[model samples]
Target: MADDPFALFDAWFAEAKAAEPNDAEAMALATASADGFPSVRMVLLKGHGPDGFDFYTNAQSSKGRDLAENAHAALLFHWKSLRRQVRVEGFVILLPDEVADAYFATRGRDSQIGAWASDQSRPLDDRDLFERRFEEMKRRFEGQEVPRPPYWRGYRVVPAGIEFWTDRAHRLHERRLFTQTDSGWTEGLLYP
Candidate 1:
């Protein structure tokens, strides 16, 4: 494996994209509130590079509120087809408004409208109410370019440590961990 965790991630991600049947970029994101209450949910990886891993969400949602109180998070990516998994721990930072806007512009028209219509993590009286709100949003933006909602934005998780694991026969597994240090990343093996 490469000394650079980002390079290793890229290589594994490419393999996953080829082998996984669907949503290769899907990951489990774990966050906590100021009081230490934790939450975990699956989210799609929207962007990634040396800088960090990015995912978007509604700022007013449960995860968002958790992140607002606590900037740290952990991510887990499991590729069942490849029998591999990657775990990342990091601090989260909001992406630049322009970056979020650019990505939002690329979403489908219906998705863009849904972003404006849905009050994520909030209680809804009924499915019909949501559908009605969606219709209203669609009509409001008809014949006009849908803009990114202020509450809808991306967050980048700056990793401090990353671990890669591959399953082997008879319950054996291979594990490699890389931790960021002041000088650079330090790699080590982990018992599996």
Candidate 2:
């Protein structure tokens, strides 16, 4: 049994990156509204460590609003080729503006513009209108570095529990769960 979930995650993620043909960093993020209604969507993992898993998004988006109202969330990474998955449950924390700014700077110019153009999770009456907005943003930032929108933000999830699952022969499997405590972390296993 590994003592550190983060270290185990690093190892498994590295293997997934090598084996998975597509985005190994992709994870399903589940967030709840103030009333505890849940929603889930796929998001790319921008960073991770003992601190937590990081991802960036538009703060006005549904997920953002949900996070604001309910700080708790869950993340799941499934690597089909590797036959492994990691589940993370934690409380969300807002990343510093500087962190968001730096990551925004690293984004491709088009994506940076899209972040500004898209009013995510909002009703869109027409697709062409969005295209026009995208073009308009491109011209608006022409010859200048596109800045992060006020609603664009970064978040980190400080994990409380992490479960590692692996496929095995037949229907049996392996399950290792690590739970956080005031002193540190406790590791245990579950029936496959």
TM-score (all chains, Cα) for each model: 0.98, 0.98
Instruction: Put down candidate 2 lDDT per residue, 55-144, tens digits, no spaces.
Output: 999999999999999999999999999899999999999999999999999999999999999999999999999999999999999999
Clashing pairs in 1: none
The TM-score between candidate 1 and the true structure equals: 0.98
Candidate 1 C-alpha error for residue 92, in Å: 0.2
| Model 1 weakest lDDT span, ten residues long | 1-10
Backbone clashes for every candidate come to: 0, 0
lDDT of 1: 0.96
Global lDDT of each candidate: 0.96, 0.97
For candidate 1, lDDT tens digit of each residue in 70-146? 99999999999999999999999999999999999999999999999999999999999999999999999999999
On the 0 to 100 scale, the lDDT of residue 53 in model 1 is: 100
At residue 90, candidate 2 shows an lDDT of: 95
